[model samples]
Target: MVSTVEVPEADAQFWRDWGDPLLVSIVDATLRANHDIRIALSRYEQSRALTHQAGLDRYPTLDVSGDVSDRRVSASQAFGLSRAHRDGELHTANLSVIWELDFFGRVRRSVESQRADTEAHAADLAGVQVAVVAEVTDAYFRLLGLQRRLQVARDNESNQADTLRLITALFQEGRGTSFDTERVRTQLAFTRSRIPPLEAEAAVTANRIAVLTGREPAAVVTMLDRSAALPVYPAQINAGVPSELLRRRPDIAAAERRLAAATARIGVATADLFPRFTLGGLVGTQALGFNTLFQRDSETRVVSLGVGGSFLDVGRVRSRIAAANSAAAESLAAYEQTVLIAMEETEDALVRLSHAQAEKAILEQAAEASRSAALTARQQFEGGMVGVLEVLDVERSRLDVENLLAQSATQQATALVAVYKTLAGGWPQLIPEPQGDAMAQR
Candidate 1:
């Protein structure tokens, strides 16, 4: 039995030190350039402004007014009075204030709702930042994997070319059959044909990375040409529990905040069923001439208080409250669903990483055996120990094994990336300024 040894856990600080350089740079660049993050931040700022406006509803609004006018009066002869006309200017100003008492908590509820919305937007921004980091890191690793595969293909092509040359020399010397030479040449051509498509795929991956980093595709490719090393997974990760996921994930937090906002909206709607109260006062002066507008005796003042309520809108108010309740229920459901999805993702990533690691070992052994078989068959052909067909068959088997190994390596890398993504939580750690400077040099 082949003794199976578990791979040692990678040092967390080693992964952090190396992985941090590229990923942190990409994340920092993304945070500055990612359109989604910028948009969310802007929305959060707008929500903050709305919250401030909502709070203002609980305070009195004051207005001052002044006016100048000319008046003409005509007297009729009904009482035998003479008609007279006069022109005058009147100046008036008022400082009027209206304050909603909020006795029923209407303004308070509205303010609460706006504040919740602001919080939700802030959480949304954090979620976007996390997603951007994961995306950029995944793309970078994929590109590196492709580069490795491309190298493998080139190596295989060179080996096949050399084998074809040997077979041709044997045929010319009457030591090998024409069929053997033709078969080797055909395999070499097929191996070379795969290079173009792999190159094209690498280019596309580079373009995706550039767009994520908020740069032109061409510029990204230039940087990628110089960039090296794939992101390494940390040695240890704590997924916490399913319940902890709800608190850690930013999307879940945002959804809960939305629910709170919806609940507050219900209060706002219910408050409308009660009367609204306002207290207003005005101080103004009216004068026949602008020069005397500030005269103490010419000044006029009025203090007023008013209460207004819509008595005929009971049905409408009830409907609005019902709508708000339904909205609150919807938000709660959304929050629950987000939590469930996060748990699912964490579990799936864990399973995939475990399985991929196991599979890699099996594939590695298969590749080694296939290579040995191909070398033995080649020697047999040279020594007349086997037919040319046997040599062709063994070579093809070796190629297939090699390709499979490459694919398995990619799968393992992808699974590792998934594990990291699940454990990253909702916010990418902020890269310190000095670290960012070092990454730039790299």
Candidate 2:
């Protein structure tokens, strides 16, 4: 249940100012260029056409015709008596109307079935839209995470360099042991090694975003040179009950639409077991010359009606009904499964965000303690109270804690993205409007 208490709108300005421009652009591009969405739209169009065709089944068809011809026959082959070398011209004009009388409701049922299918396709399109939004959001957050991690690596590398320099200077002056100097140098090298891999990872993520945005990878890489930081959340978050989420989820709606379509198909199959009726009429004039084709004396009219039913197709109709029922059942199952998955995702993201926040708090304390211990060790070593190894060990612990803090921050950002994905609230609004001139320039 939604809370009756008023909830203020979230202030996502940081995410908006930094990531929104790129994320919106990418989401719009993906919506316009994604192959699957395009395919689904085409399928919807096809269903609309089929629905129109089905509706037409209840109407009469009119055809107009006109023809002119010349004929010659030998006297011996002519009926009765005819002179040799005889030629005649014939001209005819006609109008015909044909209609199927749907007394047994077969046409009505077919039309209903096609209408249901059309609705199903429309829902499928909506589902595709939701999926695309989720994917783009996830990618954008992941790219941000990678960028932040790279920054952390760089900062850690710089810190290690500073520590190594201090240790080397002390060792040269005989104030620190050789082992302490070597250990600092080793840690510095390891920190530096991390930079290259993190940079590569960030590059790969940028490329993936580029592909989603339907742009060249190099172009995205050129555009994304800014530092990455985790996004801040609003003071309040609203998570309605399970029912609210189920109703909001696009996949569940799509599956339900499919079930409706399948149920309609059963009606269509059942209608097929009944008889069909058709009415046809022809009004025409025939004459030996075009001048008399429309004359009252030459006019002829005919009206015909037909009804047909298949007595041998009972088994086939029953099989179709059974298949449609099965399909409806399958769709219901799928809808339930989608609901379960969406709930699972929301709960998991919530847990992760809370845990990461707690972890960040602990890690902050650990880092502060390590920093103090390192400072104390340095003072002790200068006063001849402790060895250089003690100072080096504390410094290493501090660096590790700092790295863990950075990781936790990234995890929190990822959790926020996951929450957005689960909610499926972002759509055309979250994505940017198209700028024709900007796109043309690109």
What's the lDDT for all of these models?
0.72, 0.69
Give a tens-digit lDDT track for model 2, residues 8-72.
12123323543457666667777777777778778878887777777787789999998898888
Tens-place lDDT per residue, model 1, 1-442, is 1112121111133234555566566666877887877787788778877777777777788787767777654443234444433434577766677777778888888888888888888778777766776677677777876776677678778878888888888889998888778888888888888889978998998899889988899876877764353443333345666666666677887899899999999999998898987777777777878888888798777776778876359999999989999999999999888878878888898788777656756877787888899889888877889877887788777777766666666676677667655654422232332322111122
Q: Point out where model 2 deviates above 4 Å.
A: 1-19, 66-77, 80-89, 298-300, 367-387, 426-442
Instruction: Give stretches of model 1 more than 4 Å off.
Output: 1-17, 73-85, 226-229, 371-392, 424-442
Global fold similarity of model 2 (TM-score) = 0.81
Of the candidates shown, which would achieve the greatest lDDT relative to the real structure? 1
* Candidate maximizing TM-score: 1
